[model samples]
Target chain A: MSIEMTKAEVPGVPLLEVRDLHVEFHTRDGAAKAVNGVSYTVDAGETLAVLGESGSGKSVTAQTIMGILDTPPGKVTGGQVLFRGEDLLTMSEQERRRVRGDKIAMIFQDALSALNPVLSVGYQLGELFRVHRGMSRREARAKAVELMDRVRIPAAKERVNDYPHQFSGGMRQRIMIAMALALEPDVIIADEPTTALDVTVQAQVMDLLAELQRDFHMGLILITHDLGVVADVADKIAVMYAGRIVENAPVHELYKRPAHPYTRGLLDSIPRLDHKGKELYAIKGLPPSLTAIPSGCAFNPRCTQARDVCRSEIPPLLDVTEPDGTPIGGRTSACHFWKETIHG
Target chain B: MGRYVVRRLLQMIPVFIGATFIVFMMMYALPGDPVRALWGERAPDEAQMAALKADLGLDDPILLQYWHYLTGLLQGDFGTQISSRREVIDVIGDALPATIRLTVLAFTITVVVGIGLGLIAGLRAGGKTDGLILFVTLLLISVPVFVIGYLYQTYLGVKWDLIKPTVQDSEDWGQLLLPALVLASLSLAYVARLTRTSIVENRRADYMRTAKAKGLSARRAVTVHLLRNSLIPVVTFLGVDLGNLATGAIVTEGIFNIHGIGNTVFHALNSREGSTVVGIVTFIILVYLVVTLIVDLLYAVLDPRIRYA
Candidate 1:
């Protein structure tokens, strides 16, 4: 199948688009910026993987998009998240709730802990059908079994009556995926979806997601720090650092030539089978605290290309040029040495 | 699940034995003879008192008396109440239903009102609702149960004529309401506070966020995801308090003129009816054991992670 780039290729409008989103948490100490002017869009049937390390605001951005952030402590201070041309940030709680499970669903990490312990798997899975679709108990239960089967849960018919504790972690996650797909929502936000599972199971779950995405033709936002998983599932990649997206490019382009220094470091840090038994390069230093972000580029403190100018002036996401000086579609880094990094 | 219940039942043996032993020892340690107390100001002569004590096996050695009491307990015979010359079980049995009714009503009211207020308060913590609930619970808790009972009697029963004059006299909902409210007030504060803390803490659990992420409504997130998990601790507190209510609502019983186990115990003490006192204490211990077991079972059911072992 021929894959096309950019929002124009998609038949309908973007399923979800978040622009200049800034999420802050007010604490006794001060306001902590969790998500800083982050922007991305997922068109119909597109998979945009938000690739970032922990504490890099990947999950918070997803939460803001889903409208599930806790008020008081957590507040979305700025930006608009447009879902089907409606501003989700400004929607009333009731309207947002109506859209949540029915329009755009989210699959959380650790599905074993997410499902209710007391409730039967069938009951929990069937809840969406019963609540949002207004199906009867019998009908909902049948739909639940169908969902379980769709997610490849073994003995779906028999196991539907079991409780959450009875299912293994991988199975629980499959059930979570099943639940998320119940309404066939326009977008699915899988936040660190397979992080808690074993590698074998992680591959299986991600493959399941990809398979489901093709069948449903739904937009998928896969949020994770695992580049291998992202490479396998994502069509587009948004590399984040210190609560900001430093690089946004198609997956193949990003893998072939990572323009952002942080993205390059992340790509190099992974231990690949091609470099078997060699010492893996790890990105040095922890991610900067959002409460007190560095001046210049957020990654400049750790960036090897850092010059005096890189230390004082913050870098914006700029255009990356080809070897022939042609501009790529997506924004790259504003680091003065971006040409050297991309071409070298 | 069935095996779990069997194991729980077997575990109660040691508990009941320990309870019975303590009850027997404490009854003997108390000053003044039951036979003498029964005789009142006109003290029974030494020989008559001695005969009565022997007949009841109190004249036996402590070990012998304990063995007799244990045997009697096993045989479902608690001997006879000295003053009434009635079977101890019969006396407790007569009073048992009334006490149970009072306790059940009181407990239901306490949970309904307390949990309702607590949920509202906890969800709106740091808001006016939280402040109001805290104020009311603290206020009710500070005033002793008897004072609240008497106050209800004064205003609700005697003055404004909202309720009937006494618990015994009134058969209407209005009558039941005052007694239930009076008896429930003390426990209400504790339940409300427990519920508030539990719900607030439960809100912090990662699963709640997970539920929300599932795109579940806020109501479902709070009620199903948070409230059920939070209720385990509240169940424990309620279980213990229900035991106390069953055995220790003496003052409320007296103020309301209710003929229940609390009142029975009071009469037993005054009349120095040793058999009746022993019976009441033993029954109270049994009630506590049963309530504890029930709550534990409920906790296990509510939280699948909890196992008997």
Candidate 2:
């Protein structure tokens, strides 16, 4: 009856670790490199926020991890998704499916579309228990009500029979979260979970998610474009541009001193109430097309600090340093002049 | 829901009357006179003809005649058949069972074959199996119903001796199989194509991905998530198609010499039996209306979003 799995018992093993992940989309035009050598790690009870603008491949990385990418158009060329010391990429499809909801669950952005329109919320939630745990219908229904109540949905008993359309958008999203948490997986990957909600509702959902993650000591991967959304919750942040992570740092360190020009530009673009009358600073130029990304640094054309070296050679994610030349632990930047940007 | 059903029932009143009025007007405007047809080859005397006309209320104004006919309908009197002098209701009642049997059999076959083929085609979309199913359905759709009927009768019935060649007066399931299959061919094609398209569209839906993400196996996800949603449009199509099949049974019934309502209507139309024709037309309209109402209720049942209130 207990849906909980054994925790990440080994202290040294990371809950989830992605190494050198490469994904490309094949089209008539050419292959669009969506995720290029992306890697990150999430420890138990850690909140890792992946931040990027539209078409930056953050969502694609999440999809690849979930093994939900549409093939024929999108393909994962190379990657190692290690969950608790086991490689998921090489696992059999059946084995991976068992791991999907039981080990790592996902919450999608558009709750209205993600929930089946024809099915009741309770039935949809109950399906997880019925399919995986082989629970009886009555037991599953009871668990569904319990999950609804856990997500703080009002009138859970009465609204259990209501269809997806019957509930409000926020309620529907809570239902999505409840479904993900039903099996109490070790990791929960939420792809832009609060992007479709109103500002107030967004905070509530995020708060609830953070609370749940902490209470369960689960690894939470929050994928979003808005830096402000993850500022309070994320312990670490990875900023991506075009298909690569341009900067990675602790949340406070990144906020205090962005090591990449794109990260700096994004932080500056956030509108402030103090400067209401002043014009808000916007990033210059658009993101490069994935199929024809610039040779050197993809952001060089739009970057203010473009130089000869930056235009001629692609930069690997190198260890970022302070003005005193002291290396910042767990901090790396793909920019050639990371020191200057950090100092400035 | 009860109120909704009552309102829908009340709304059918005007539709029923309008349908019956159209059939009555068309029969009235026909070239031949029913009185002359009643007299056959022998010419009736002027007084005899006038008396017959007065007795039948044919001498009254068209509007008055229609009103009289409507009142007779309300009183459960469909009038008498001109040829046999039998009550129209009794004639229709005798033929009703045969038509129902054939229609139901054909409809059941259509649903089973159409949905089965559609599911297979959708699961293997863009593959050879899908193409083959599509090709067969296209062939069925392109051919006319009468041609299919005759072809099946000749090939499967007479030539191959697969089943009985003609439908018998007794209730023999074997006798009805060939005709039922022939009648179902075109509709089967339509329903199959619709199902395939709907399934293909639903396969790309976000909920289907959600189903897969919930640890559902590929096959289970397609059946439980994709099939249920895809079937909404197919159910709607079936409701209308069932009514059409009932009316279309006439041609097939005639081809196979089956004594159904369609055959009765055909004979009445050719012989200028006004009362019988009108009675049958009205009955078909009522059946069509009832079938559509049931379909609408089913929509509410299948899709909780569609509340009648």
Candidate 3:
């Protein structure tokens, strides 16, 4: 098999790699290019945080990779989603289905809406084991309780029979996490897992996720627009703007000096204690509408440092480097003047 | 669950009394004395009529008469029918089997055909099948029940001779099939529309997406997750419809000439047989009460969130 050959030939190849993924949504008005040539990688024991504003195609990209895109409206025009040297895009639906929730699992946002309200949490959680592993109902139920306990849900035995409405918001999100973690998947994609939770609970959920990722050593792709929430948990960050990744960097370095104007705008927009009295910075304009993205760089109209080149030509993602031409490891920026933005 | 049932049964006692009392009062309020109406254009001797009235307790006050009737009813003694000189209980016993057969057959057709078509239409919403279902249901709703009955009788019965125009044998399934279809037609339309709306609304729900993402097969996702939630409203509608089907459908019964409760009540009303009408109407009320209670309980079973104390 190609997987065996690739494992032998290419040692330490990324567990999952998304190469040049393009997804579009056809509407009555026009076709909205929701995801435009997104590319990212997730390796074992690594976390890739996809950061973006609304309409940035971060979630859409994840959906495409997971093969859960609503395809009548959304059409995947081009892409190669490589999972362990196999093209998930090219795979049959049956094979892709096997890979989902077994090889790779996903945790959705809005746990209340995501879970089946009629079914018990135990049944929903136990379903994965029953369907994929062919475990007896009793075995699956026992496994479900263990998963609940692992996620720190209080009195797992008692709560296993409880429905989604019975659980608190934090507990519900924990149950969602528990579902994703049940099978010990090689990779997990959590789409805005804490967006629906309180500020205090957000940190708790993130900590739990980080701990689980450590314990499982799974490749994690944490998708969110919150710059601060993913800081401690994410190893690397991909900043997306108007359906494209404008910057990809190791998380801490990007925070210190953002190589893209949009990333800088996002970083500056974060509220700080010292700047409490002063009016907070906000990205001046709204994100570009996907249906009518700018001809050049999609963020050109909103970029404060926009020039004629930025207006007329799309900037390719160039490698970020120092003034002396010493390259920064694992850094790239889609900006005409990356030097000015990062090291100026 | 047990407590809820007991509470509901106790509540039905008042309903039963009220329903029976109203029907009894209406029969008493009719212009002509039922005894006189029973004799058609024939002169009855004044002494004979008075003796018959005294014998039947018609000389007593209406309340006292109703009390006698209620007491007899409690002891499973429906009074004799004046016009036919037959026991009201015997007439009901003859009619109940026919009504049950029609109701059960119609209910099965409504649930199976209505829900089956609805699933087909809803699963393919915005397509040709959905449009066709919409048009058909609209047509069914617009046309009155009597018009459909006559048309089916004229076309399917008289002209084509596919089946008998009327029920020849009240207890026979073969003869009752056409009548049941006519009875079920309107309710089938409603169930289909209700089911389609629910399925369309829930087909793309977030939980459904979760089911798919969880790697659930298409069959399991629709049956276990989508259908379970969608059927809650449809089942509630079907519950009331089933009760209505069992006791109602007087129009269908008349066209088909089946000796069901509705027809029996109709014939009794025309002949001014007070005992027969009051007796059957009371029985219909009891059936409705028990059925609605069953529906309420079934709601809890279908949706765990709905708990009855």
Ranking by TM-score: 2, 3, 1
| Model 3 global lDDT (CA atoms, 0 to 1) | 0.90
Instruction: Count clashes in each candidate, considering only residues at least 3 apart in sequence or on different chains.
Output: 0, 0, 0
| Worst 10-residue lDDT window, candidate 3 chain B | B31-40
Error of 2 at B128 (Å): 2.2
Candidate 3 per-residue C-alpha lDDT over A244-291 given as tens digits, one digit per residue, 9 for 90 to 100 = 999999989999999999999999999999998999999888888889
lDDT score, candidate 1, position B197: 91
Off by over 4 Å in 3: A1-12, B59-68
lDDT of 1 at B237: 92
Model 2 sits at a Cα RMSD from the real structure of 2.1
Model 1: CA > 4 A from native? A1-12, A273-279, B150-173, B307-309
- Name the lDDT of candidate 2: 0.91
Please, what are the lDDT tens digits per residue for candidate 2 over residues A1-344?
Answer: 11124342657878899989999999887999999999999988999999999999999999888888888689999979988877888888888888887779999999999999999999999999998999998999999999999999999999999999998889999999999999998899999999999999999999999999999899999999988889999999999998899999999999999999999999999999998999999998999988999989999999999998888899999999878888898899999998889997
Error of 1 at A77 (Å): 2.6
Docking class of 2: medium
Error of 2 at B94 (Å): 1.1
> What does the interface RMSD come to for each candidate?
1.9, 0.8, 0.8
lDDT of 2 by residue, B102-218 (tens): 998999999999999998898788999999999999999999989999888888889998867788762676788888888899999999999999999999899987887788899
